[model samples]
Target: MATKPEFLLIGPGGVGCIAAFTINYNHTANVSIVVRRDYETVRKHGYHIDSVDYGKVDGWKPENVFASVEEASKSGIKFDYIAVSTKNLQDIVPVEELIAPVVSAHSVVVLVQNGFGIEKPLFAKFPQNIVLSGVSHIGSHNRNGHIHQMQSDHLVISAFENPNVDADSQVAAANRFIEMYSNNINKCVYFASAKWYRYRKLVYNACLNTTCALTGVDTGRLEAAGGLEAIAIPAMKEVIRVAKADGVELPDDVINVVCHADDGDYFEPSMRVDVKKGNPIELEAILGNLLDTARKLKVETPILDLLFKLLTVVQFRLKEANGYVGVPEKRPIPDTFFK
Candidate 1:
């Protein structure tokens, strides 16, 4: 009999735990996870999940769990799909370096994170491997070993073209992943290109995520302060303009859909949560990269530019507190390091 395909997920945060749960729930492949802080708690007690879509499932564990990717690499298993659902904080460490130990030539790297230009570095690092870009719209948070998934989950995935790898092989790997991962309970759709979805998501994120972090408020508070109309909507319009300049034209109605996305049921975005915990936010991947593209395309984005500048100060404070001072040195790994 043919062996079942192997799947591994790094970063068992809110998003990572839920994805691992659902993928293991499907039981189409062998699922494994690499967890850091909560490894002991999870390995002993397992995950306590309360999801609206999947309902309550306590003491849930994947087939195998490890403390780190380096540990998982020594398990004598070649991973078919390695999904990363961590925050895209490239300043701290590149995603490419984090999962380098287990990325085989046959393995497909799936990025289930936010921000623009996130897939570029991974592609450059693993041109021989197929890299898939994923944009996840899920509302979940993990406190200790307990996870709460308040909103329904939706993931849009697409393969990033690699000149070194052929097109047919890339699509085949992507389809295999979707086949094993997607089910009747959770939604994961395959799109032709994930660029449009990335831009559309920023219509909500670049405005509310940044503003909430700076002002230390939630969505309802921002709307109550007239920021929904004054700050969020206008900034979303600028994002649409920038997307248009970059060849992805977003509809005008997206402003209304995104601005009032959380009308009465409002919660804090990830950036605000990071700010509350004094963690470094994804400053470069989300706003800085978008603004760089705007400047190159000659698109006017005064609102986003101001938000970027102010958020940079917030980021500097977090970095200073963590003592990440001065320029970072280049971290070089062997080109043939993958198994």
Candidate 2:
């Protein structure tokens, strides 16, 4: 009999739970979830998934749950793949330690998170050969202890191709990972060249996330307010220009998709949630990255610059108010043609 691929998921947050559930539900992979604590809770309660599409699935326990990577290592457990889904701001030290023992030179490490260039920091810690960067449009949040999946879109996997890593091999691996959830489901997994996938996602995020965050409205409402023509269209053009300056080739249709994507009303950008909850937003990851890239490539980004400035002020005001409970003055975007 073929041995099941050992999969280890670090963190049991919304994304982590969905990944764990997806992997366990569809594939024969021997999956385990590593948590900082709450092993008892997970063991007793199992994994609970409340999805708008899949409905509620309860009492589904992982093959194993470990409190820490240290514990898993001491128990002599080895993982073929490690999926890191921690919050973007969490210290990477713990994650490094967790992957240290289990990650081999050949083992694949898939990072399912938002933002651009998140793989750079990890590359400094681990060999680039084993690192794979992924971006997904999967919306999920935790309610009580259950994970609620709001939407499932395509999962894009990318990494710098190496001789040991055949192009087809990565695609096959990505498909295996997707099959963990795509059975009879319309959701598909795509493996593509890192440059195109990363930049495409970057453009989509740069437009959609920033607009949703700045407007403090849901995606549907934002799209309804001529956001595509006003914000997303302009912002996406800037993204394409910046990507071109950076030598990243983007498709002509990328802008159209960003402007007209069916992201659903239930979709909530992380930055908007952070602003609403008064948590520190990923200004650096979403907007800051675009601005920085533009500067690096000598590309002008007036729209992004104005957007970033507005968001910075909004964030500061929120911090001053201690939360979004009180209303703040609505700042108008300075007049400028970014083209």
Candidate 3:
């Protein structure tokens, strides 16, 4: 009998919870979720996954849960795959330190966070061969300590064949990882050839997240106003220009599928929720990366530049007014929108 591959998911937030539940439900991987000390509530209450596509799931618990990476390491448990789905602003230094001792030399780390340039910093510490990048169009939120997954479009993973890893081995590994979650969720996971998935998702996120946060409107209102195409088309073009300079060959359909999709208001991006809660928005990950790439490629992105500056100012002001701490309560809808 073949042994089940062991997986460790760092962080138990929305994305992390989805990843853990998906992996556990499929039973293809032995998954463990590493959370903070406060996650004892999860130990008692278990997890409730309320998904729009898959329906409701209750009493779902991980194979194991640990308060800290150090504790998991002390247990002498080695993981074959490590997936991280934490927020963008989190400091991963401690995670890297604690997990390093428990990761086998052949173990692969899949990062499902936002942004484009995250791999560079991670590769600096870990072997480039063992690092992989992924992007997802999954929308989710936490309500009253339960995870509500609103949408699952598709997950794209970038596969690379390192000198230490053969092409067939890497392909097999990627396939196994994809199949592990194929049945647990409604979305499809595609393993793409190049690393363009990150850039493609970056373009989609930059426009959707920034616009929704700035307007303080839901996606439905944004679409109703016919402003999606106006903002998204130009932003995608600028991203394409910058990506090409970086030697990435993005497909023409990336923009068409991402920007022109007809998903309903249920598709609220994470940045929108962050702004609604008055938390620090992921400006650095979504827009900062775009502007940084443009600067490097000498591409002009005046629209993106303007949007980034505006969002930064709004985030700063909101933080200052809200005492710069704690999640903000949902704000009341404006009278202007009620008309």
Candidate 4:
């Protein structure tokens, strides 16, 4: 390991930027962010963040910024961790192809993304490297290319349970990673079962994210328009049921907490923002993956099934509105990844 932990954070959107800011603000680790669109602007002015919780920070630059992972990888610098906030790129490019140049034999790979089965391809390639799954409860979004910090509790974290990998090493690496990040933001809770962590976050994403996207509103508006009871609550119920079928039990009152987030903590989720911007939403990762798993488990998610069909229609329409014709490529999941 290097004397100081360095990270290559891919996809500097809401989720990615918050993590980048938290670490960079606390000066916890040296962060190298991949600035895909606004390289020059970010390199010069950095970002101006407005927040209700994290306070305001104007013009903060990370340690290093690269246009792409390939560019960063060629710097002859191996990062201790690679944090990805986008959908898994197994279909577009192999994980090894993307991060091989930036990692050593013992690099810890952590993905703070929303979805299921995010670890399969990574484990398939790097059977010995530590792999972790993170669940972010942050109610934040990006506005005019800056992260808007809203509210959050604990960031649920866990390393995946892989039979082929050394379990003890994974736990130790996870604890070390969490320790490096404990100085900033909020609490970092280490959950032993990454499987359970992923599904529980899906309870909110599969319900609120999709509901807000389809209705063209934020969580608070959805609750105001009565979509909370008419839509969100039922969808969460389906999520709980499917989670159980997959052998993860959830609490009975999760619905109340999931729907009514704090009183003024209403912000458009990334899904709603993506739909409005005519960009392809993370439908597959947040919704498609869940529906697929529900099917494998033979769990009947009537509400979720309906919302899935409806959201796909809205997603297609939004893409068309943006003049994007080609459908996004989907990844084929292996049966071995399932529990």
Q: Pick the candidate with the highest TM-score.
A: 1
> Where does candidate 4 stray beyond 4 Å?
25-28, 49-59, 87-104, 139-154, 220-227, 262-267, 320-339
Give the Å shift of residue 33 in candidate 4. Answer: 1.5
When summed lDDT is taken over every stretch of 10 residues in candidate 1, the lowest stretch is 325-334
Candidate 3 residue-wise lDDT, 267-301, digit = tens: 66778878887777767767886687789889898
Give me candidate 2's TM-score against the actual structure. 0.76
1 versus 4: better TM-score goes to: 1
Error of 3 at 304 (Å): 2.1
- Model 4's alpha-carbon lDDT is 0.77
Instruction: Please give each candidate's TM-score.
Output: 0.89, 0.76, 0.78, 0.81
* TM-score for candidate 4, residues paired by index: 0.81
* Candidate number of the best lDDT: 1
* Model 1 CA deviation exceeding 4 Å by range: 326-339
TM-score of 3: 0.78
Query: What is the lDDT of every predicted structure here?
Result: 0.87, 0.71, 0.72, 0.77
Compose the digit string of candidate 4's lDDT tens values, residues 156-223.
Answer: 67998777777888888889878876664577778989988778778788888898888899888888
In candidate 4, how many Å is residue 54 off? Answer: 6.8
Order of quality (TM-score): 1, 4, 3, 2
> Model 4: which ten-residue window has the lowest total lDDT?
87-96
Clashes per model (N, Cα, C within 3 A): 0, 0, 0, 0
lDDT of 4 at 84: 79
User: Which pairs clash in the backbone of model 4?
Assistant: none
Better of 1 and 4 by lDDT: 1
